[model samples]
Target: MKKIGYLILIICFLSCESETIETTTVNEELTAQQKTVTTNKNEAVVIRFIAGLSEAEKSVLRTHYGVTAYEKCSCGDENLESWNLEAIHEGATIEERVSSMEEEPEMEGADFNFDIQIASQVPTDVISGPIHYQNVLPKIRSQKASVTVGVLDTGIDPTYFRFQQPFLHNTVLDEETCGNDFFGWNFIENNNMPIDDNGHGTIVSYMIYEQLVNTATDFQILPAKAFDTDGKSTLFRIGCGLSYLIKKEVNIINMSFGWTTTSSAIIGSYIKEAEHNILMVTSAGNTGENNDEIAHFPSSYPARNILAVTAVDGEIPPTLVPILSNFGPISVDVAVHGIGLPFYTTAETAPTSVTGSSYASAKAAGFAASKYQEGTAMAVFYHKILLDKIQSSTLLQIKYASYLDL
Candidate 1:
């Protein structure tokens, strides 16, 4: 099969809430054009090809089209070779491009590339009140390594004291093909150390750790750094991250980041493959737009065990509409505290304040982890209970069948 290039269109804007002051940071670098994959005029945007290509077919691809085959990365996921590829060829259109190759004597009816897509940009911040998830923990059945939660973001701050709690096991994954990482793989530097340079991942991981780790000692947190120090990543990296977690048999995955457009087919396939095995919790984005109108990936990806969470402030008749959060009575699954909440950043030991849907999603994932059971994690059942346990005062009464609607 011909591999197609997948790009991730990421847009990030962050805000923090503190008792004394508030801060906002807008990242203008992430956009559609900026995020698109670039190839020379003579190169073709291909990801991976079907295995067992005859010698003749290989010659046609290399000599005739100047296409070069190479491994996607050292992440060690077999799907990486099947889902991501790059080559050099000229084609007027995607269909036409394939037709020309098929015209060859041995190439007739041969499949080549799979469609690719850009990734969504997901965010964080917090507001405090009566603790969420407190009541739900006792109801969950806990066991050692009963559930593993994957945190895919910039990276985690392993040195954080809060994360050092004996009950909390922030287990580091071994990227054997590459080496051993005490924390997680840094796809940016292709290194074992996935320490957070940007503060986004730290906040995302911290929020979840604080909420669930101590409550559920048997629950494990696996950090998979998909984004770089600048808070940017491609759909390929995101896919690899998911694949790694899936191999680890993680029960829940927290994607505190998002993209506004449809997700790439390759990543979608991975999500589909893990549909029954994992539950994905993604942020609704910080755009404040309606996701029902303009879909967000992983969140909008119609699949099983995927929950899209929006932000809500801690107020009487709680404000489900965060000034910087995206919502879709139809697209989002729930709303939680995402206003001015105190948390830690990569650069600081003391707690700082932040606000966004990313934080809300983390909170939701943490809650899900608390309730998750390896063999009996019924998506619908847990979803119902989650909605039931959510602070009634903090939830919005929407028309859609959403957690907030409860």
Candidate 2:
């Protein structure tokens, strides 16, 4: 047990209009260098409704729309008249069903939805080598961290030696708060035991842990697990997870996963609401595409509190190497050393080599926690402290570096 901490989170609140964030593509269409998991389910559609429903109305849904089953994400005030959810129908794909709901006059009047945010997985495997844990990073500030980072992803392995005891923060516990025995909220199972079934969460956790440990920063990790063994966080899950983190009042959030969508009002509402409260650090994704063209939330979300982090490789100075991380001079705020980095996993005996913007964002989270100025958090505060913003269009785009450089 190297540290100790505490937790709460509630989700986005906004607008009377129902929504359909079209997360249609998996967005992993990359070269042979990049690989990711793309998931497409044809049976259901996620919907966000803005009206309070009665049993009579629910019955009508069952009788008319064949809504055999539905799960609602109660991420906001129970009194609030909004329901983010998904339902299973008899036939047709998610897209078709969403279209059907919107066109149906009765459902439209009953608070129908738009924008389909499909799910996606990040690029896990990368070029590899023997894991190395013996490097002296240049920036080691005397200042210890005085914040909590809510990690939204697959849960972490508390069984791991590093994750046990004080590593996990304890929060107010009860029927409404985090259970005394758990690390954070598990949206996947709607419980407090957010143990990592998939290794993605552990890898991301390990990165932030290592950075803080090596830097001698005092901090706690709040595990807001929304993804499970399937390693996917949909719109509803993300909302539930964000709801948890916000309630916890974490200083920083590390989101190493994303989905590409144009109309992301569902997710954007949260981003806009949390703009002045919490600072969000997210991966620009490993798709190697320009984020300006393909908006990846909540990174691509136009918010002052959200930062889109990209990945770059090689030692600083003369050896910089570009990898497959997504980037846009405007969309992506900065870059970090995220290529073929060494990380640990609970499923494996020792550390392994992996690449993706996920690790980059994790590193950036630690950096933000180290540099976070207590007071009102402004995204531009971190953005302005860049060591040097690259200006040469013809030169190598290696201008990005860890905030420690400054």
Candidate 3:
């Protein structure tokens, strides 16, 4: 089958208490383009292929296209390549980039095509009803655990009011900045600290901290920037960031970003680290596709007992699942509130509402970390308390229907 390229389009969130965030659409077509430009003798230039290429084509691409990195499809088959330029030329001719070969790659395994599905809406009237917090927070707060939760995403704003305390550490910068102090390290720039070009990371950090504050629980929040403001980062940078966390042996790791394919080396290293008993929670992705068809990677990688969470909109009655959330047996471990949730902003000035599986993954991370202090494996803790609640609730519903039939 033809390899598919996935793109994510995000809509901004309004005020923290806002009921719903608007949705946006992504382009459906995939095409390749090339441009020729004048080059200065001292300036270096790079050519990137907008689509996948073959190994022989890559060799030809290197000779003609001058790109630093070629974009490769993560579907196990290598089909695309990009080129970087070392020098610019005014006389350089831009050629149309395309694959001469037309044969489609073979699809192995199951012919599963997973699409994003919207679940029932959550009831807003019972917003004050008994939530998981009512049952778990009290026990956790009383213990005053020193558990640390790591957020791996866009860099956070340290000065955000919700994370102003000393408990918040920016692992990317190897420095501790308060909620009122915002500093970040940009892996793209090879900086010492993180900076929030995109507000998403800061928002996610705020959500986790807010949960801790609301629960009166004492836990540390470690901010790790895996993506930059442009919503992009190199696979090497991500691998390095995770390596840092593994070295620290933190209690929980929250990852909200993923691509179509994963690096086996990087994933294997993480699995080895997980063997040390650290818990990982990831976003199932917002592709709005079934897990079998286009599930996000890293979250979809074959790992034992990882928590892959889907997003749900809380503004709608009955807490319906977010339409963009990718789901399948292999993709989603559970669902959590992602939209219309209150969280802190990059300015740390006030709280705001934001939507995305990023927040859902954060919530899961915070919840799991809180329970870890109770001496439970992160996966086991969530499975026993949280997953059990969901499974049992479903079972109860089925039993009630059978009883009525009898």
**lDDT of each candidate versus the true structure:** 0.55, 0.57, 0.46
Off by more than 4 A, model 3: 1-145, 170-186, 261-263, 315-322, 344-352, 374-379, 382-388, 391-406
Give Cα distance to truth, residue 341, candidate 1, Å. 1.2
Give a tens-digit lDDT track for model 3, residues 243-302. Answer: 556545567777777665422333444545465466777776765656555546567766
TM-score ranking, high to low:
1, 2, 3
Q: Which portions of model 1 miss their true places by more than 4 Å?
A: 1-71, 81-144, 166-183, 345-350, 384-406
lDDT of 2 by residue, 219-245 (tens): 778788777665655556776677678
- Residue 156 lDDT in candidate 2: 68
* Clash count of each predicted structure: 32, 20, 48
State the weakest 10-residue window (summed lDDT) of model 3. Answer: 1-10
Q: State TM-scores per candidate.
A: 0.68, 0.67, 0.55
lDDT of 1 by residue, 225-267 (tens): 7776456666556766777777666688898776655445556
Best by lDDT: 2
- Candidate order (lDDT): 2, 1, 3
RMSD values, in order shown: 11.8, 11.1, 15.6
